[model samples]
Target: MKYLSLIIMILMSPSCSISKKNASVVKEKLIVTFSKGKCLGNCPVYDLYIYNNGRVVYNGIDNVKKKGVYETLIALDTVKRIEYLMKHFSPEEIGNTNGRDIPFTILKINDKKVVYRSTRSSGNLLKINNLIENIKDKL
Candidate 1:
């Protein structure tokens, strides 16, 4: 009888799997767009945020910092743009990420997107203009 009680106690303990709480965390994807490194024209630096729930948030040019940091929510309303960004940028930079994937901050889109390449590949400026141009076709 005592052994049965001990087994029951162990099963009912806080550390038991039945007592554990399920995680409520949700993963999200975000894209940060740019016109120039430091703002050169009317092209607004856009940041498109994409949620796993099919929801999106947009941050336009006005909210962007004057020095040139920009980000906004990606619009699901336009599947063309979303598909373009995901298909191209994913293989080029890091795909539809949660924004913590890369190190460098100055994301530019003038002639091309200059992603900070890794040190092993010489850490040099990896010019992705061609890829961007190809993606531009889809846009």
Candidate 2:
């Protein structure tokens, strides 16, 4: 009986409590990502990842004010708004291009991916650009 009590106490100790690390490890899946490609001129090249848990990560490579890696936790409302925008726009409709000189924008949602390499950006691409800017502002 004493040995059983000791084992139960050990199991219920704070040290054996749910680990924060383990909880964080179960992160929300990737919701959307926007990647800016290099241009002939000094255009900011970076990748932005928006996770379902309202976690945003920006990795800036060159010609940008915010360089290096940046992480921000956005509000749940913002996360929902982004998800709505992505669903409404529908990435599958955007066609892929191979414009090397002009800057390109890559928008991805789960398995569906779209790359916009047009110099004259419009329609859904413009909305995506606006969405990225809105996210950046929030961050």
For candidate 1, write residues 1-139 as lDDT tens digits.
Answer: 9999999998777763433443323243334232222223443344433343334443444424343332233235443443344345543343332333333323443234444422211211222332322222333
The number of the candidate with the highest TM-score is 2
Which 10 consecutive residues of model 1 have the lowest summed lDDT?
117-126
Q: Kindly report which residue stretches of model 2 are placed more than 4 angstroms away from their true locations once superposed.
A: 1-20, 90-100, 137-139
Best by lDDT: 2
lDDT per residue (tens digit) for residues 1-139 in model 2: 9999999998887663367766676777888888988989998798899888888899888988888889988887777765666667644445556556778788787776777764455665566677676776565
lDDT of 1: 0.36
Runs with alpha carbons beyond 4 Å of true place in candidate 1: 1-22, 27-38, 63-139
lDDT agreement with native, every candidate: 0.36, 0.75
